[model samples]
Target: MAILITAKNLKKSYGKGKNTVHALGPIDFTVVEGSFTIILGKSGSGKSTLLNLLSGLDSPTDGTLVVAGESLNKLKSGKLAKYRAKIGLIFQFYNLLPNLSTLENVMISSWLKGISVSKQDATSLLKQFGLEHRINSNIKTLSGGEKQRVAICRSLINKPAILFCDEPTGALDTANGQIVKDILVKLNKEGMTIVMVTHNEEFIPMADKIITMKDGIIESMNTQISK
Candidate 1:
């Protein structure tokens, strides 16, 4: 498989001098196209920071980062926003607009791309995720698991080549979390590259590769047969 993301001597930090905090690399890494990879790390282990850097949401203080063939280090703010749309991001919080219905929330993401996503498609995706009845419901009225499902629908609105998820299953119960995991794995099988950050060990069984990070660097990486 071809490499979809590559980092060389990548470095990021917070504060300065005595208060400095190293959040990532001076390390090299590559993610193969269409692979489902899990990044495991505890709090303060730089998992979130690394995701931001990889997605071009933040600039690195030093070194080089390239994702999906774009040099993130070279993008200006406007360019970065466009770059981000190509790689969908799902967060622990659904981040839906409270006033918008579930279907509307999903459509809004595609609207940002200036494309009018069909209601039929949005409804189909949500229905497949077991949220057909919630299509016209207000986001604030939904349960935690339902909200997360809406977030997943929004993330896929653009049909991105890659998905970056930060604790996507964090707020859900075990059954719902597993449901989300299965959906992600199905998407990966259909050729969507997924890079997810999670502390949940249950996700390990679904991962094509497991990458563990400690402090500001990768501690270990293990690949397994895609089941």
Candidate 2:
């Protein structure tokens, strides 16, 4: 497989001089295309910081990060915005507009990315996520799991090359989390690259690459064939 993400000596810090705090990196790794990679770490371990940098949401203070052939360190704001359009992001809290229906919520993402919105395509994605009956329902009316499924549909509407998720199932119950996890595994099997950061140990074996981080650095990295 081709490498889709490459980081060399990547680092991030905050404050200055004696007050400077190193948040992440001076680390390196590559994510192969279509691989499901998990970043495991505790709170304040810099896992989220690493995700932000890799997804082009934040630039590193030093070193290099290239995603999908774009050099993040060299891209300006406008270019970075364009680059981000090709990357999908999911958060612990379902980031949906409460007043928007499920279908509208998914449609809006494509519109924001300057892509034409197609209701048929949006409905198709919602159906694929088992949300066909809830397509026209308001976001607030959906259950936590249903809402999260909508968020995933929105993320995929742009057909991003890589999906970056930060604690995607942190708010759900075990059954619901499993529902989301199953979807992620299916997506990976179908060749969508995924990078997920979580404290949940249950997800480790599901990845093609597992990276464990602690105190701003990688503690261990293991590779396995996708199950």
Candidate 3:
């Protein structure tokens, strides 16, 4: 498989000098095209930081990050937005607008990107996640799982080459988490590359490879047997 995302000795820090804190890396990694890769770590283990760096939501303090052949270090803010449109990111929190309906929430980015998509197609994708009935419903009324599903829908609105998920199931109950996992699996089968950060042990069995991190470094990268 071709490499869709690559990192070379990637490093990040907070503050400077005496106040500086090394958050993650000086680590090297890659995500292959159409693969499902998981990064696992406990709280404060830099899982979210690494995801943010990879997704270009945060800049690295040192080293290099390349996604889908674009060098993040070389791109300016405007170009970064265009580059980011090809790489979808889903946060632990749904991050939906309170006044927007679920369908409208999913369509926001696409609208900004100037994609000519209809409400009909947006309705269809949300319905695929069993959210059709709630299409016109305000985001504030949805459950945690439902909100996350809307986030997933929003992430896919642009049909990105790679999807970066930060603790995707962190707020969901077990059943809903499993449902989200299944949705990810289905997306993977359809040839979408998925790189997820999670502490949930249940996700381990679903990963093609599990990479563990601790103390701002990668501890191990293990390939998993099929369940």
lDDT scores of the candidates, listed in order: 0.88, 0.92, 0.87
- For candidate 1, which ten residues in a row score worst on lDDT? 218-227
TM-score of model number 2: 0.96
Once model 1 is optimally superposed onto the true structure by TM-score, how far is the C-alpha of residue 203 displaced, in angstroms?
A: 1.3
Residue 212 accuracy (lDDT) in model 2? 91
Clashing pairs in 2: none
How many clashes would you count in candidate 2? 0
Off by over 4 Å in 2: none
Candidate 3 vs. true structure, TM-score:
0.95
Task: Using lDDT as the measure, name the better of candidate 2 and candidate 3.
Answer: 2
Tens digit of per-residue lDDT, candidate 3, span 1-227: 89888889899999988999999988898888988899998878887889887787877888889999998866677888787777788888867888888988999869877787788888899999999889999899999999999999998988989999988888889988988999998998999989999888777877887889998899998876574
User: What's the TM-score of each model vs. the native?
Assistant: 0.95, 0.96, 0.95
Q: What digit string (tens of lDDT, one per residue) describes model 1 on residues 83-140?
A: 8878788898878889999999999998886778899999999998899999999889
